[model samples]
Target: MSDCNKTDFTNPSTFILLGIPGLEAAHVWISIPFCTMYAIAVLGNFTILFIVKMELSLHGPMYYFLCMLAVTDLVLSTSTVPKTLSIFWFNSREIDFSACLTQMYFIHCFLVMESGIFVAMALDRYVAICHPLRHSTILTNSVVAKIGLAVVLRGIMLVLPYPFLARQWPYYRTYIIPHTYCEHIAVVKLACADTRVSSYYGLFMVFCVRGLDMIFIAVSYIQILRAIFSLPTKDARLKTLGTCSSHLCAILAFYIPVIFSSLTHRFGHNVPLHFHVLIANVYLLVPPMLHPIIYGVRTKQIRDRLLRLFTHKGM
Candidate 1:
């Protein structure tokens, strides 16, 4: 496979995603549930976006980050969910080579953006709690806009090499992805050419983006916790922590499975295929579903606003 020239485009024009093995035989049964989950994920994230946008009171740094998160979830889910559902529904799991790279690029791009948003949320909480006097001044509109621009530019820079490396790889006649989505590692592994460079680059970007973001979040929360402890009143301490509880929960839910999945893929190759699939799906789906619930339940303002919106709509 490596012997084939990169210029030789005469090989496989379309790649097939093997999809879920057992259910591949029963496409109809699989399609219904997958499609339903996709719809719910999209609608739920869109609702979060709408709530944040419509409620002017939710325009603070916290909600601004939340809205950005909602958008990321929508884009992330959109990139893979529809394609997965289509595979099950129509038994049409074929994706073009260029299309696969595009999907992989967007998936990775949003992933980095999501991490950036999490870091920004942590900083917002830190300012609000630790430096209350300068919260507004520190997280001003101009500053937030700059942060957003930085996040987008950084995300693009981080993932740009992936598609380029992928395009350079020689494709064998066989191009079948085992997973539902166009995962970066999964696609890279299929490259007939030596993928050492691509793999190393991917790992480097993943670590730099997620690793640094996690460290920043950890340090921010440490400062926040220190400030909380310095508070004279227990209620003040609890209140300050409570304000970030939702974001903390979201960060945990989003990153833990992802980190675990990546580790399992790298070090636990002997593990069962089903175990990898289950964890990977959880990493993708669980956060999108849990995010709105975490924010809505943890933040009374969001919950009340949602209730009022539904109540008025009911009338």
Candidate 2:
């Protein structure tokens, strides 16, 4: 282990992904449910964007941000599930080194991009409720476009370093990533070289991306709360609170699972490998699956349009 050569630092040309840990025998069955979830996630998010685009009345600040969220969900789900299903059904586990890197980059990139969109949505609600008269000028479509551009650029810049930093590190040991997905930190753990730099950068990226977004979102809601309370009647407060339910559902669904998954990844050494794998997979899958459903059910605009599109029914 002490002996180090130049080759020790060379990137492994390929890697094997170990699908679900103890459930190897049941991987085929497991993939059935996994595929169903992925189908719903992809189709659900696409539906959100499709309805938003089709219905002119749905064209507004909130729905525009919803479109961005749907796009991120689509990217996030596709990046992992297709390869994951292949590994389960076809026994295709070997992934090219570059492809693995690309997957890791997109996973983190879209994950953070999703978080950024949530923050943007929170800000949208804050402006809508807190400063109602100024909401139009404040959250104009042009401004939303600028925010979307910033979010995309931010995610790209933050996640870009993961691959570049890992590419230079030599892998003297095994190239088998234990997790089903090639997450940034999980893959970084495979490098034989000193990975402190990349590890810390990954942590920083986590804080900059997820942590900062969560902070801003919390702050936005706090201001929004005060504004809602200032309303003259309880009905007004309740109605305002109701408007935020979808965003709140999304934040809780994503952040709670993510927090547990991160903790298990960093600290849960005694935890079963499958347990860790399950939480991580769910962390990614649940939001995309639920976000569109929550919005469709909770937002009258989307639900009405979807119902009309489906049944050609009612005024």
Best-performing candidate as measured by lDDT: 2
**Predicted model with the maximum TM-score:** 2
Error (Å) of candidate 1 at residue 23 is 4.7
lDDT of 1: 0.83
**Model 2 agreement with the true structure over 197-270: per-residue lDDT tens digits:** 88778667666668888899999999999998999999999999999998999899888998788777877899
Residues 177-265, candidate 1: write the lDDT tens digits.
88887788888877777789987887776687799999999999999999999999999889878888999999999999988988887
Looking at model 1, report the run of 10 residues with the lowest lDDT sum: 2-11
Report how far residue 285 has shifted in candidate 2, in Å: 1.1
lDDT of every model, 2 decimals: 0.83, 0.87
Off by over 4 Å in 2: 2-9, 313-315
